[model samples]
Target: MVDQSHSFYLTSSLQQKLSKLVLAAFCLFTLYFWPQRFELWLIQVVIAVAICSYFSYTIYRLKSYKSSFTLHSRNLFKFANNPNEFECKVLWVSPLLCAFYVLPNTEVEDQAGKSQLIIVWRDMLSDSNFRHLSRLLLYIRRNQASG
Candidate 1:
């Protein structure tokens, strides 16, 4: 692959859909376990209101989130909202997720003690970019493990 930076908008469409589906399933599960007879109608109303509130708030939060990322080779990445592009070390990688340990400052740390692990989700980028990133991350994962 060329040593070019890939700018990605973190819309995460697929992940959002999957999460919504899972949450909807959980709501259904809650309904299944809910009382059969409305003997205590007040308790039923409370349960219903609580579940709906949780579901709505979660959906709102998901929809409101917006971010952009730029990956500049295996060792460097930056958030678009941030001004500086910082050096980060790759921690681990899988098909669906990759973790990067970002140094606290712009440079690499001695012990990496202040490194923060940030997750890059699969759906954060386009299909081609995500695949390219996955390959790069896998390579980094291999090198990190042995070093």
Candidate 2:
């Protein structure tokens, strides 16, 4: 439903980077100071894995976007070469890290299907594009609420 074309990039602002760094530091500190308990160790491992995965995905998204199609519509579209169109749901929107979501359209059989895609502030979204996205999301929410 969107006419404005926007490109995607693996970018983050200084504020975002600093916030993430602080979070990582806090996790690391906990891992180092917490007592030598098995449960604590497990928690640390999980946190570390999550942190690594997030960073890895960020890099992967950028590289993939380089070769994938550009975002031109507000509806579901392919961001990669994969022959699948994604349906998006706006979970949350913020200046730091907006929670843009997408799910597969072929998951009609699945009972639980949800995927999150985060859009950082430094991404290539222009002011007009962001406004359009926000407006589209609001419209979707309104329709869903009514029906």
- For residues 55-129, could you state the per-residue lDDT of candidate 1 as single tens digits? 777777776667777776555667787665566677767777677776655354453455557666777767687
Cα displacement (angstroms), candidate 2, residue 2, comes to: 8.3
RMSD for each model, in Å, please? 5.1, 5.8
Q: CA lDDT, every prediction?
A: 0.68, 0.56
lDDT score, candidate 2: 0.56
> TM per model?
0.58, 0.54
Listed per model in order, the count of residue pairs whose N, CA or C atoms clash below 3 Å is: 0, 0
The alpha-carbon lDDT assigned to residue 111 of candidate 1 equals 33
lDDT tens per residue, model 2, 1-147: 435544443333454555656766676666677688987888878877887678656555544343333344445545655565667666766553455566667665552464647554534455665565556555555555566
In model 1, which runs have C-alpha deviations exceeding 4 angstroms? 1-4, 27-48, 60-65, 84-124
